[model samples]
Every structure is written in C-alpha cells, then in structure tokens.
Target: MHYLLRRLGFYLLAAWAALTINFFLPRLMPGDPASTLFARFKGKLDPAAIEALRATFGLTDAPLWRQYLTSLGHVLQGDLGVSIAYFPSPVAEVIGTGLGWTLFLAGSAVIVSFAIGTLLGVVAAWWRRGWADSWLPSTLIFVGAFPYFWLAMAALYVLGFTLGWFPLGHAYSDDAVPGWTWAFTADVLRHAALPMTTIVLVTLGGWLLTMRNTMISLLGSDYVNLARAKGLPSAQVALRYAARNALLPSVTGFGMALGFVLGGSLLTEIVFSYPGQGYLLVQAVRAQDYPLMQGIFLVITLAVLGTNWLVDLIYLWLDPRTRDAGS
Candidate 1:
C-alpha cells in the first residue's frame, strides 16, 4: 500500500508538470499567434482593438508572473481561450468536433491489433517449434521496424492506385454528410478502412514481438513444467497455466495503446489527408494556432495518463503478485 501510494503521488506530480508545460510552452514560442492571425487584417482592427488582442491572448504589456497565473487559472477552468486561427470559437469546440473521429479510428485499430497480436502470440507460444512459432517472430520484427507512413504509402499505391479498390484519402467519400444514419456510417467506415488497416499493421507487430518473447521466457519456468507433468490436457495446461501467466506484458502494451488513441499517427493522417486530431495538430503548429495546439496536446496527455492509471488497476487483477505485495 505504501509503495502504491508513492507511485500514485509521483504520477500525480508528473501530470501537474505536464499540464503546466502544456499551458505555457506554446505561448513561449518565438512568434506570437495573435499577430500571426492578425496579419491578414493589417488595418482592420484599430490600435485599441489590436492592443485588446494582446490582452485577449495574455500577451498584454504586463508582468510575466501575472500573465502566467491568469493563464493557469483559465486552463483550470477549461478555457483555453479563443483560437487565433479560427477566431471567436473556443479551442474546446475545435477539439470536440475532431475528437470523435480520432477516438473511433485510433481506438478501434488499437483494440483490433492488440487482440489479433495476443492470439497469435499465444498460439506461437503453445505450439513452440511449429511453423507459426518459427516464422511469426521474424515477420513481426520486420513489420515492427517499418515506418507507419510507408505502410500508408504502399497501401495507397497498391490497394488504391494499382487496384483502385480501397479509398486513397479522407475520412469519407465526398457525398457523405455527417449524420447518425446507417448510410453515412457505412460511408465513414469505407473511408476509414485503409487508414485503420495501415495503423493496425504498423502496431500489431510490436505487440506480437513483445508477447512472444515473454512467452518464450515463461515456457522454462517451474510452474509451466509442473503443469505439464501433472498430465493435464494440453489445451487446458496451455491456456490455464502458461498463456494466462504470459499475458501480463501484453496487457501492459494494451494499456499503452489505449493511452495513445488520442495521439493519432501523425504521418499516416498527413499522407491520407484524414481530418483526425493528428492532421489538425500539424496545421495548428504550422499556423501557430497556439491554443488549438495546446488543447490537442492536453487531450492526448490526459488520455495516456489515464490509460496508465487503469493499467495499474488491471495489473492487480491479472497478476495477483501485485496485490500480494500490497498486503
């Protein structure tokens, strides 16, 4: 209990540090976001209003300490200020609109890949020296080292250009309107297919490699040998004894995936012109949409932090060793 509490306290401090950096780091960039946005309207806003713009963005001709405190307060209240690029709309709204697509595509892909990888790892472990056991690790290592954008590139070339089968870009076909209707949903899926597939392929390999390695180590343990010598059915021993214990590493990886669902694969989105948060982040950074960038960063950070928190809880369930230590 003491150790767990200590870990929790450290993570809490880490989260606060992350939030503080997220609040101010963007504004500390060399260029001013407000001025960047106001570039097009040189004479549109008179002197007073332009000065007000400085105040609006917390760039007022005031002390840095006061501005920092004010910014911190606003951040606590979930007011990331009006987005300079979008003008008038709150940063939250922009993030809100894009969050769904991000969660749907990235979240589903992570879960699917983790499931498939875990199954394959278990099979390889159970049937060691079999065809899959010999071949899967080599293949997974190859794929794991391959860059995600390259997969998107190849898929675009082969599946899209050469065959004209899957979509080449975007979250949906041009005609598909945003709605809850079945037709719209189908179109979204159809458009989502290629990107999601690429994401899965890129990520699945890492999980397989990690889980397979752990399984190999677990195979030589006394517990596994004892289970085998007991004359239990091979299937029962394999699953109930060996695979269950080997799954802890994979579960940790799953927690990481859950955390990263908001931090979409940036290059993949860029290649496909997908409007997920990753794609938005690229543009936001380029245009110096500081508030928008900050919002996305915070959302992604919280997601990962929260996922890790749940991972600790899962550890207690999957491996009672942790709970035993607690007592």
Candidate 2:
C-alpha cells in the first residue's frame, strides 16, 4: 500500500508537469496560427475577423499566466478549442474522429506483437540450442534493425501498389458506410492490415529479444531449479516457474506500447495516408493548429502516465516483493 501510494503521488505530480508543458509549448511556436489562417484566405476576412479567429483559438492578448490558467481550465472542461486546420471543428471532435482508428490499428498491433514475441521468447529460452532459438531471434532482430518507415514504404510498394493486395490508403473503402455493419468493419480491417503489419514486424523483435534474455537468466535461477528438482511437469516448470518471472520486464514494455497506441505511428500512418492521430498531428503542425497540437500532446502524455500507473498496480500483484512495504 505504501509503495502504491508513493507511485500514485509521483504520477500525479508528473501529470501536472506534463499539463503545464502542454499548455505552454504550443504558445512558444514561431508563428501565430490565426495569422497563418488569415493569410491563407488572402486577407479577405479583414483584421477584425483575424483577431476574432485568434480569440477563438484561445490566443487572447491577456498576460501569459492568465492565458495559461484559461487553457488549463478549458482542458479540465474538455474544451480544447477549435482547430484551424480542420476549420469549425472543435479540437475534441477532430481528435475523436481519428482516435478510434488509431486505437484499433496500433492497439491490435501492440497486443499481437507482444503475445507472439513473448511466447516465442519463452520457447526459445527453454530450449536454448533448438532451431527456434538459433534462427528466429536473429532473423527478426535483423529485420527490426531496418528503419520502420522504410519497411512500411517497401511493403506498401510491393504488396499494395505492385501486387495490389491491400488498400493504398485511408481507414476504409470509400464506398463503405461508417457504422457497426459487417461490411464496414471488414473494410476497416482490410485497410488496417498493412500498417498493422509494419508496426508489429518492427516491434516484435524487441520484445522477443528482451524476453529471451530475461527468460534465459531466470531459467538458471534457484526457484526454477528447485521446481525442476521437485519433479514438476516440464510444461509447468517452464511456464509457471521460468516464464512467469521472465515476463515482468516484458509487461512494463507492453504497458508503455499500449499507452502510445493512442499517439499512433506517425510515419506508418503517413505512408499509407491513413487518417489516424499521427497523420492528424502532421496536419496540425503544418497548419499551426496550436489547440489541436496541445490537445494531442495532452492525450499522449496522459496515456503514458495512465499505462505506467496500471503497470505499477500489476506489479503489486505479480511480484510479492512489491507488497512487502505494506505487509
């Protein structure tokens, strides 16, 4: 209980710091988003309209500290202001439109990669001299060494453009209606396949390598040796004894990956022209959409903090040592 409380207080302080940073960072950018927008219209809107645009974006000429408080208040109220890039759309609405797709694609990829890689790692470590240990880790790690965006592009060109196997871009077939229908779901999945593959293939190696190393070290531990000496079943000794201990590091990594799923893969989404949060971030940056940028940053920061907190909770259950302070 003490450990958990300490962690919770630490995370709360970190969250407040992140919030303050998010509020100020966008304001420090080079140009005014309102002026940029007005310029795009060739001054057709006159200076008054331009100032109104600035005010709408929470860019009032009030003292910096006052504006900061206002921004913080708006965030608490779930009002992220309107997006200049996506004119007339509230920042919340813009993010909401793309958040689901980002979650679906990146979330699925993270889960699948972690599961497959961790399993492979356990198997490889258990039978160190076996073929799975010999070739699988080396091959995947080698492949993972390549740049992620490069692989995404190569795959997109070969599979999508050349063979025409999957979608070239977007979240679904243009003809498909947005809904809970099977057809819509299928189309969404179809479009997600390539980006998902890119993310998984790139990330799968790290988990596999980390788990393999951790498992190998644990297999020689006294607990595992004792379990073996007790005449436990081979499977039980391997899983319940060795793998369980080996998985702690992987759990921390998985939690972090799950948190960033909301941020989406910037290059992967851009390569495929998928409208996920990453791609939206690019748009926001290009258009100097401060509110939208701040909103996205806040979401990513909160996600990371939240997932790390959850991992700490899981630790209290998984490792008996973590509970000792309270006990």
Candidate 3:
C-alpha cells in the first residue's frame, strides 16, 4: 500500500505537469491557431467572424489563469473542446472514432509479445546452458537490433507485397463497417495481421533476452541451488524458484510496454497509414490543430501515468521484499 500510494501520488503530480505543458506548447508555437487558419483561407477574415473564431477556440477573451482552469475542468469532464481541423466536432469525437483501431492493433500486439517473450524467458532460464539459452539470445539479438520501422517495411515488402499473403494497408477493406459482426471483426484482424506481426517480431527479442539473462543470474543464487539439492523435481525447482525470480524484471518491462501502447506505434502508424492516434497526431501537428493535439497528448500522458501506478501495485503483489522496503 505504501509503495502504491507513493507511485499514485507521483503520477498525479506528473499528470498536472503534463497538462500544463500541453496547454502552453501550442501558444509558444511559431504562429497562433487563428493565424494558421487564416493562412489556409488565403485572405483576411471579416472582423465579426474572426473574433467569433477566436472565442470559439478559447483564444481571445478570458484571462490566462481562468482559461487554464476551464480547460482543466473540460478535461475532467472528457470534453476536449472542438478540433480546429474538424470544426464543430469535439476532439474527443475525432479521437474516439480512431482509438478503436489503435487499441485493437497495438494493444493486442503488446499482449501477445509479452506472453510469448515471458514464456520463452522462463523456458530459456530453466534450460540454462542448453539450446534455450544459446539459440534464444542470438535470435533475439538479431531481431531486437532491427529498427522497428525498417522491420515493418521489410514485412510489408516481403509478406504483404511480394508474397501477396497479407494486406498492404488500412484497418479493413473499404466496405467493412465498425461493429461486433463477424465481417468487421475479421476485417480488423486481417488488417491487423501485418502490423501486429511487425510489432511482435521487433519487441519479442528484448524481453526474451532480458529474461534469459535474469534467469541465468537467478539460477546461480544460493537459494536456487539449495532448492535443487532438496531433491525437488527438476521442473518444480526450475519454475517455482528460478523462473519466478527471473520474471520480476519482465513485469517491469510489461508495464513500460503498456504505457507505450498509448503512443500507438507512431512510426508504424505513419508507415502503414493506420488511422490510429499516432498518425492523427502527426496530422494535427502539421496543421497546428491545437485541440486535437492537446487531446491526444493528454491521452498518452494519462496512459503512461496510469500504467506506472499499475506497475507499482504489481511489484508489491509479486515481491514481498518490496512491501516493507519502500514503506
């Protein structure tokens, strides 16, 4: 509880800081939102319309502190204000439409990668000095060092294009609708296949490698040798003793990965033209869509903050040593 409370408090503070920074970043940008919008119109706007636009975006009238408080209040209510690019539509609405795609693809991929990697790590550690330790690290190193975007490009080129096995891009075929129906689900999975594979391939290696190393280190500890000498079954001794200790590090990695998913595979989304938050952020920044950008930034900041709190809880659960140590 102590550990969790400390982490929770830290996350709350960090969230406040992140929100404040998100508020000021756009104001500090090279041009104001109104000017950027005006540039698009290619001419001067009428006085009445110009003032109305400024007021609509919360830019013209209110004191800075009042505006900040109002913005924070709207965030708490999940009202992210109207997107400049998608005028009259709230930023939340724009993100809501695309968030499903990001979560379905990236979230699933992260879960898959964590499962496969952790299992491999356990197996590799248990079989120390055997093929599990030897070949696994080599395999992981080969894959881990490959740049994520480049690996994705390779997957697209070979599997998607040349082999003609998977899709080239998009979440589904144009005819597909968003729903619980078989068609929509299948379409989502089909479109997800390529990006998912790329994410898994790139991420799996590091987890496996880290776990294997931790396992090797754990196996050498005096307690593990004692457990083995007690005539315990090889599997029991390996899993109940060595593997459990080795997995603690993997837990931390999994927490970090959870936080990262909210960022939604930025380069990968751009490369595949996936309409996830990451790609939308790119467009928002380019057009100086302050509302959309702020909304996305808040989502990511909250995600990271929330994930860290969860990690602290997991640590307390898994390692009793942490229970009294931090308190």
Candidate 4:
C-alpha cells in the first residue's frame, strides 16, 4: 500500500511537470498559431483578425505565469484550444477523431506481439538446444533487422498495391459506415492488417530476445534447481518458477510499448496513409499547429507515465520481494 501510494504521488508530480512543459514548449517555438494562420491568409483580413485568432487559440499577452495558469485551467476542462491546421476545430475533437484508430492499430499490435514473443521465449528457453531455441531467435532477429518503414513500404507495395491482397490504406473502406455492424468491423480489421503486421514483425524480435535471455539466466538459478529437485512437473517448474521471474523485464518493455501505442508507428502510418495519431502528428507539425501538437504530446506523456505506473503495480503483485522491501 505504501509502495503504491509513493508511486502514485510520483506519477502525479510527473504529470504536473508534463502539463507545465506542454503548455510552455510551444510558446517558446518560432511562431504562434495565430501568426502561422495569418501568414497562410497573406494578411488579407483586417489587421485586428490576428488578435482575434490569438484569442481564439487561448494565447494572451499576459505574464507567463498567468498564461500558464489559464492554459492549465483550460486543459483541466478538456479544452485544448483551436487547431491551426484544422481551423474552427477544437484540438480535442481533432485528436478524438484519430485516437481510436491509433489505439486499435498500434495497441492491438503491441499486445499481440508481446504475447506471442513472450510465449515463444518461454518455450525456447525451456527446451534449450531444441528446434525452437535454435531457429526462432535467429529467424525473428533477421526479419526484425529491417527498419519498420522499409518493411511497411515493401508490404504495402507487394500485398496492397501490386497483389491487391489488402486495401491501400485508411482505417476502413471509404464506403464503409462507422458503426457496430460486422461489415464495418471487418473492413476496419482488413485495413489494419498490413500496418499492424509490420509493427509486430519489427518489435517481436526485441521481446523474444529479452525474454529468452532472461529465462535462460533464470533457469539456472537456485530456486529453479530446487523446484526441479522437488519433483515438480516439468511444465510447472518451467512456468511457475523460471518463466515468472524471467517475465519481469519483459513486463517493463511491454508497458513502454503499450504506452506508446497512442503515439502510433509514425513511418508505418505515413506509408499506409493510416488516419492515426502519427499521421495527425505529421499534419500538426507541417502546419505548425501548436495547440494540436501540444495536445498530442501531453497525451503521449500521460500514457507513458500511466502505463509505467500500472507496470509497477503488476510488479508488486508478481514479485513478493517488492512488497517485502516496501514494508
């Protein structure tokens, strides 16, 4: 309990710091959204329009501290200001449009890859020198050696463009209606398959290698030897004793991967034209959409911190040593 409280306090502090940074970083940049919009229009509007634009964007000539407090208050109210790239649209709404696609694409890929890779690692380590142990790691590493964008491009060209096995991009077909209907769901899955596969292929090797190394090291530990000597079932000893301890490092990695799910695979999204956060981020940067960018950054920061805190909680459950030490 004490341990979790301490961790919760730490995360709260980090989130506050993140919020502060998110507010100020964009202001420190070369130009504000109002100026960027004014430039785009070639200043044809009334000169006073720039001030109106600034005001709409929640920008002010007040002291930095005052502006910070106002921005913080707006953030707490879920108002991230109007986006420069998407004029008249609130930053929150723009992000809301893409957040679901990103979570479905990147989130699914992370969970699937983590499960498959961790299972493979456990199997390979439990049967050292066997077929899986000898073959799986090298093969995965070889495939994973290629960059994500490179693989995405290759897959897109071959499977999507040339072979026409999958749709070219986007979360669903243009004709597909957004709903709970099976047709829409299937279309969404079909569109997601290529990019999701690319992400999994790129990330699987790291998880597998980490788990395999940890499992192998744990297999020789005294606890494992004792479990074996006590005539425990081979599967039980391998899983309940060795694999559990080996999973700690992989859990940490999985948490980080899960957190970044909101960030999406940038290059993969670009190649596939997926309407996710990564593509949105590109649009934000290209248009100098400060509010939009800051909103995205804040979301990603909170995600990372939140997932890591969850991982810490899982650690307390999985390993008694942590609880004992905390006590």
Candidate 5:
C-alpha cells in the first residue's frame, strides 16, 4: 500500500511538472499563436484583430505568473481553448474525434507484437541453436533495422499502391458508414492492416531479441536448475521457471509501448495519411495550434506516467522481491 501510494504521488508530481513545461514551451517559442494565425491569412488582419484572436485563444498580455495560473485553472477545468488549426473548435473535441483511431491502431499493434514476439523469443531461447534462434530473429531484425516510416512507405507502395492489396489511406473505405455494422468494422480493419503490420514488423525484433537474451540468461540460473532437478515437465520448467522470470524487462517495455500508443505512430500515420493523433499533431504544428498541441502533449504525458505506474504495480505482483522490499 505504501509503495503504491509513493508511486502515485511521484506520478502526480511528474504530471504537474510536465503540465508546467507544456504550458511554457509554446509561449517561449519565437512567435505568438496570434501572429502565426495572422500570417496564415497573409496579414490582411489588422493589429487590433490580432489582439482579438489572442483573446479568443485565451492568450493575455498579463504577467507570466498570472497567465500560468489562468492556464492551470483552465486545464483543470478541461478547457483547452479553441484550436486555431480547427478554428472555433475546442481542443478537447478535436482530440476526442481522433483519439479512438489512434488507440485502435497503435494499441492493437503493440499488444499483438508483444505477444507474438515474446512467444517466439521463448521458443528461440529454449531451443537454442535451432532454426528459430538462428534464422527467425536475424531476418526480422534485419528488416526491423529500417526506420518505421521507411518500412511504412515500402508497405504502402507495395501492398497499397503497387499490388492494390489494401486501401491507400484513411481509417475506412470511402463508402462505408461509420457505425457498428459489420461492413464498417471490416472496412476499418482493412484500412488498419497495413499500418499495423508496419508497426508490428518494426517493433517485433526488439521484443524478440530482448526476451531471447533474458530467457537464455535465466536458463542457467539456480532456480531453473532446481526446477529441472525436481523432475518437472520440460514445458513447465521452461515456462513457469525460466520464461516467466525472463519476461520482467519486457514487461516494462510493453507498458511503455502501450502508453505511447495514445500518442499514435506519428510517421506511420503521416505515411499512410491515417486520421490519428499523429496526423492531427502535424496539422497542429503546421497551423501553430498551441492549444491543440498542448492538449495532445498533456494527454501523451499523462498516458505514459499512468502506464509506468501500472507497470510498477504489476511488478509487485510478478516479482516477489518488490513486495518484500516495499514491505
């Protein structure tokens, strides 16, 4: 209980610090949001209009401290201000529109990749010197060496454009209505397949390699030897004794990956023109949409912190040492 409380407190403090930084970083940028918005209109708007735009964005020429306080209060109230990129639309609404797509795409990829890679790693390690160890990891890692966006481009061109095996972009087929219908769900999955494959291929090798090495190291540990000595089934010894312990490091990586899913795959989304948070973030940056950018960053930070805290709690359950130490 004490350990969980401490971790919670730490995350809260970290979130506060992240919020403060998110608030200031945009303000300290070379130009103000109003100026940027005005430039987008080719400066036809007068200086007085700029002030009005600033006021609309909740920007004030007040003291830095006062502005900070006001910003903090608004954030607490879930008022992320109007997005200049999406003029008159609140940041929350814009984010909410795209958040589901981002979650579905990135979240599915992370989880599936983790499960598949971890299983492969266990097999590769347990059957060391076999084909799985010698062949699979090397081939996958070789492909994984390419950047995610690079792979995304290749996949898009080959699978989407050249072969026409998948749709070119977007979350669903153009004609499909957005609803709970099987047709809409099938279209959504079809659109997601390429991007998800890109993410899985790019990330699978890391998890495979990490788990393989960890499992191999644990295979020779005293407890593993004891399990073998006890005449336990080979599968039980391998899984319950060796693979379970070896998975600890990957657990942390999985948690981080899960958290980052909320941020979406920026390059992959851009390459595929997927309508996720990453694409929205690009639009926000291009339009100098401070409120949108800040809201996205805040969401990402909170997600990461929240997932890490969850991982810590999992650690206490998975590893007895954590519980003992905490006690």
Candidate 6:
C-alpha cells in the first residue's frame, strides 16, 4: 500500500509537470496560430479578426501565470479550445477523429509484434543454435535496421503502387462508408495491412533478442536446474520456470510501447498519408495549431503515465518478489 501510494504521488507530480510543459511549449514558438491564419488569408480581413482568432484559440496577452491558470481551468473543464488547423472544431474533437485510427494501427502492431517475437524468442532460446535461432534474429535485425519510412515507401511502391495489392493510403477506401458494416471493416483492415506489417517487422527483432537473451541467462539458473531435476516436463521447465521470469523486462518494454501507441508511428503515417494522430500532428505543426498540438501532447503524456501505472500493478501480481519488496 505504501509503495503504491508513493508511485501514485510520483505519477501525479509527473502529470502536473507534463501539463505545464504542454501549456507553455507551444507559446514559446516563434509564431502564434492567429498570425499564421492571418497571413494565410493575405490580411484581407479586418485587423480585429486576428484578435478574434487568437481569442477563439484561447490565446491572451495576459501575464504568463494568469494565462496558464486560465488554460489549466479550461483543460479541467474539458474545453481544449478550437483548433486553428481545423477551425471551428474543438481541439478535443479534432483529436478524437484521429485517435481511433491511431490506436487501432499502433495498438494492433505492438500487440502482434510483442506476442510473436516473445514466442519466437522462447523457442529460439530453447533450441539454441538450431535453424530458428540461427537465422531469425539476424534476418529480423537486418530488416529493422532500415528506417520505418523507407520500408513503408518501399512496400507502398511494390505492394501498393506496382503490384496494386493494397490501397495506397488512408484508413479506408473513399468509396467505403463509415459504418460498422463488414465491407467498411474489411476495407479499413486492407488499408492498414502494409503499415502494420512494416511496424511489426521492424519491431519484432528487439523483443526477440531481449527475451532470447534473458531466457538464455535464466535457463542456467538454480531454479530451472531444480525444475529439471524434479522430473518436470522440458516444456514446463522451459516455460513456467525460465520463460516466466525472463518475461519481466519484455513486459516493461511492451507497456511503454502500448503507452506510446496513441502517438502513432509518425514517419510511417506520413509515408502512407494515414489519418492517424501522427498525421494530425504534422498538420497541426504546419498550421501552427497550438491548441491542437497541446491537446495531443496532453493525451499522449497521460496515456504513457497511465499505462506505466497499470504495468506496475501487473508487476505486483506477476512476481512475488515485487510484492514482497513493495510490502
């Protein structure tokens, strides 16, 4: 209980710091969204319109502390202000539109990569020097060495542009209506295929190498030797004794990956022109949409903090040593 309380307090402090940074960082940028909008329109509108735009975006000439407090209050009330890039749309609403797609793409990729890589790692460790152990890691690491955008572009050119296998970009085909229907679902999956595959392929090696190395070290541990001497099945000794303990580090990595899923794969999204948070972030930056940028940053910060907290709870449940140490 004491340990959990300490962790909770730490996270709360971190959240406050994140909020403060999110509020001020954009303000420090050279230009404000209002000025960008005014320039875009060639200054045809009344000069007062720039002030109106600033007001709509919750910008103010008030003292820094006062403006910070006001922004904090509005955030607590779930009023993130209107987006300059997507004017008339509240920042929260603008974020909401891309949030789902980002979650689906990055979330699915993380889960798939972790599961597959972890399993392969276990198998490779269990059969060290075998074909699976020999070739898999090197091949995956080679593939992962290339940048995400490079692979995305290559895959897009071959599978999408040349062979015409998958849709070139976006979350779904233009013809598909947004609904719960199977056709729309299938189309969305089709569009997601290339990007998701690229992400998984790139990430798989890290998980595999981490787990394989950890499992190899644990395989020689006393408990594992004891399990073998007790006449336990090889599979049980390998999995329940070795792999279970070896999984702790990978779990931490998985939690971090899951936390950042909301941020989306930026370069990959840009390459594919997917309507995810990463693509939205690019749009916000280009338009100098401070409110939207701040809103997205807050969401991502909270997500990371929240996911790590949950991972701590899982640790308490998974390893008795953690519980004992906490106690």
Which candidate number has the best TM-score? 4
lDDT of 5 by residue, 6-118 (tens): 88999999999998999888878888888888898897899899999888676888888988898889889998888889987989999998788999999899999999999
What are the per-residue Cα lDDT tens digits for candidate 2 across 106-154? 8899999999999999989999989899999989999899988899999
Model 1 clash pairs are none
What's each prediction's clash count?
A: 0, 0, 0, 0, 0, 0
Clashes of 1: 0
Question: What TM-scores do the predictions have?
Answer: 0.92, 0.95, 0.93, 0.97, 0.96, 0.96
* Candidate 2 stretches greater than 4 Å from native: 1-5
CA-lDDT, candidates in order? 0.81, 0.89, 0.84, 0.90, 0.91, 0.91
Give the per-residue lDDT of model 3 (tens digit) for 1-327. Answer: 666777778889999999999988777777667666766777767767767777766676778888888878888898888787777688999999767778878888998998998789888777777877789877877987898899899889999899988888888888887778998888878888899988998889888888878988888999999998999999888888988888898999898888889685897888777889888889888878888988998999898888888888888889989999888
Please write out the lDDT profile of model 4 over residues 76-174, one tens digit for every residue: 999999988988899999999988888889989999999999999998899889999999999999999997788899999999999999999888988
**Candidate 3: regions farther than 4 A off:** 325-327
Candidate 4 vs candidate 5: which has greater TM-score?
4
Please report the candidate that would top lDDT against the real structure: 5
For model 4, what is the error of residue 170's alpha carbon versus the real structure, in angstroms, after optimal superposition? 0.3
RMSD of each: 2.2, 1.5, 1.9, 1.2, 1.5, 1.4
lDDT per residue (tens digit) for residues 1-327 in model 1: 665676678778877888788756765778776677677587787778777877777787668777888887887798877776677789888888678778888888899999888888888877888999899878876776787777789889999889999878888888778888999888889888988888888787777777777887888899888988988888888788878888998898899889888876677778888888888788787777888888899889878888887888889888888988866
User: Roughly what TM-score does model 4 have, to 2 decimal places?
Assistant: 0.97
